[model samples]
Target: MTTRSSPGIAVGVVGAGSWGTTVAALTSANATTRLWARRPELADEVNEQRTNTRYLPDFTLPEQLSATSDLADIVRTSDVIVMAVPSHGYREVAREVAEHLRPWVPIVTLSKGLERDTQQRMSEVTIEEMPGHPVAVMTGPNLAKEIMAGQPAASVVAIDDPRIAGALQRLFSTPTLRVYTNPDVVGCEVAGVVKNVIAIASGMGLGMGFGDNTRATLITRGLAEMTRLGLALGGELGTFAGLAGMGDLIATCASTQSRNNTVGRRLGEGESIDAIVESMNMVAEGVKSCPSVIDLASAAGVEMPISEQVVAVCHDGRSAKQALVALMDRDAGSELG
Candidate 1:
């Protein structure tokens, strides 16, 4: 297996979505990064054209980066593996990676969703499949297109071991992209997943023509529920105030680039879930992660009113307008309660 290059470690990124493609290209500047695409044709385009046209249209990738369709090639030829697949594909890909993955190579998850049936976080799902491999999550307010456009951004690398987290922090860190380390993996994962759900609510408000005050209220109150659930899951309260929580929430809620937000906007504009989903190529994680977040909140005995409304709109066949009315009519309580 190929190990470290002169300056940085070799990285194998599985999944060639917009975020994955952007990350692999960015990492290629400092490391030998290979991105794996599910389709051979897509892989060939990335290899020959140095671009993933379907995912990151009109964006050019670095020459140092490569693409492949072989999972074994990635697992066997890299020092580190980055899991960038959506949550729906995480397990199947994890099982495949496990068969060929080396013992010491750490796997970092870039997914921001939970397993539907298990309701387990991305890091937990990785460890379950690859028991001996170190698992970590890399997350923040990173919009793939913005990063690809070379706009400066910061993110957190969360893992239990400070040493491993530090090593990864350096591997992903660039001059324009700063990577911070956090030992609270739970908080990071929870924040990453829950923010998408909240973004949907925020998007619905935007589609319904709500003012900035309404948007601000959803964001602030959504954060409260996120912190409460994260705390119940053994995450640090302070972690929720950092990039993975507040930063990510703001970006997803406010930015038009977010897929979850777009889905919510369309739903609020009177599009049915079936029609919207059928027309899209990319997965809107909040649509699937909504129920799982509700499940987690229920298990923790926390009241996530916004998340519950999101679930109602996405899954229970409730109209977006109806969900908003229900949320607004609920009994009021203390801000911190």
Candidate 2:
């Protein structure tokens, strides 16, 4: 890891999607920040227009930030690298960059959602691909559009090394962005992945025209399910109360801006998953995450009723009403139970 005594450091961002562009824009303290995009044309546009018109339409990128299609140049120049690609692409992209990355260069992941086949978190994929490299995750109630607009936001940086987390806190922190550090890497990963499933459930409630009573119940119960699954997977309970957990869940589940929520709303409005997915160019992570989350909960012997219902509705063609009925009819128990 390129350890620096000061806060300002060189950073590399891999991925040119909305989230990546937003982070690159927010972390402008870096003397030289390179954003790696797959399309050369997109990089050129960003460099010339001072805006990622396709991804982040409204905000202009800083002149100090450079966009590139070359991973070699980015990895060679960056002191800290961030992977913001989707979870499905995590392993492949990490392995591709691993060959060029300097040893011990701290890698921060901003991707949420679990691997469909491996059921692994983004950090797990990173470790498997780049052995002995330090890894951390950044997550919270961050909406890309809001952050791009310079809205005040608070986020958590979870890493195994306190020093690394502290360094990252200084690197990414801005006047509008408050950054906190934590050592519970597993807890952070679990919270980031599982909350998408809950967001899907919450979106279903909204689409069905459910009232505040129903939404409140879903949020509370969703937190319970998240905590149960997190604990079963060996995560700390307090982590669920922090940014990666409740903070992320609230932003995702309650907002129409969330891709997962948008997917669920479309599903509730009688659109087929195939049709909905085909209409949008961007990925809706919850649709892909549902089955894997269900599988993980099953294997862990943790009852995730909300997640299970979401999986059934999305994958099995179960009607939203029917799924809700089945959930309500489950054997009753105490609120805590």
Candidate 3:
């Protein structure tokens, strides 16, 4: 593990939202950290009050972590840039950063959702925008609030380049944060995207007031669906059992802190999707990721019943109960099948 005193490394975090702010706080032990927010006022708040009132309210930021709204300044100062923006804005953000990014500066994607229009994963979006640059994906059961509170957490950093993965492992592996490296970028990306869809399904279970038994079943079946889709896309089967797969599935589905869960809860309460989204300024990734996941599954010839139900509920206005009934009434088959 690389200590805060590690030399010759500076970190820049893009996006000043909850996850981005949390990443900044987690790495603040290293003095050379800069957080980029599109809003200058939010940046000033981080620099002056040491708190991100907009996203992570009431949590104090570290003094060592400075904030900026200038992409050029971020690119000029940091050796490693962490992309923490929402999935929808990922491509635009990557394009903006590409113009200013220094050569060979490794970019790590911390976003989990797939692009709705293109159905591309975060790493794919990054590679398209910034070709030839070293790209890595950091994913797992990482909750920004928990990480900021100094809780023990583990995550996988997937990169084909061992050196790039090792560098990230060194930079991000603090005493409270355990970082693992994997070569299955495809597996990691697919798992990361599909887990959010399952999280919505899990949330619907919660909304329906189901007990732990139902939750467990949804999560297990969700994992199966994720594995099938991932393997069909050339991902390693074991990757679905790791941090980016079942781990993320459990965390996001069970926690109220998850945007997808919140969306599902609201839907259960009879709130319209548009109203719920408009009221909450943040993005609920599952709502955006559902259609894309279904598309990907169809294209890859993978069976994803839970994901399909989520897409119907979120987009087609099917009630959560109806979706669950549909899933339960499906033709019975072997669990492994």
State which candidate has the highest lDDT: 1
lDDT of 3 by residue, 89-197 (tens): 9999999899988887888898888988888989899999999788899899998888888899998999989877886776777789999999999999898888888
What TM-score goes with each of the models? 0.97, 0.96, 0.97
- Candidate rank order under TM-score: 1, 3, 2
Model 2 misplacement above 4 A: 1-8
lDDT of 2 by residue, 1-337 (tens): 3323444467899999999988887776534578999999999988998888877777888887789999988987788899989987878899889989887888999998889889998898899998888999999999999987778999999987888888788778888899999888888888888888888778788888886787788888889888988898888989999888999998998898898888877777777778988987677888888899888889999888988998988889897777789889999788898
lDDT of 1: 0.91
Off by over 4 Å in 1: 1-8
Best by TM-score: 1
Cα lDDT tens digits, model 1, 214-330, are 889999999999999999999999889999999999999999999999988888898988898898889999999999999999998999999999999989999889999999999
> Model 2: C-alpha RMSD to truth?
1.6
lDDT of candidates 1 onward, in order:
0.91, 0.85, 0.87
Model 3: lDDT to the true structure:
0.87
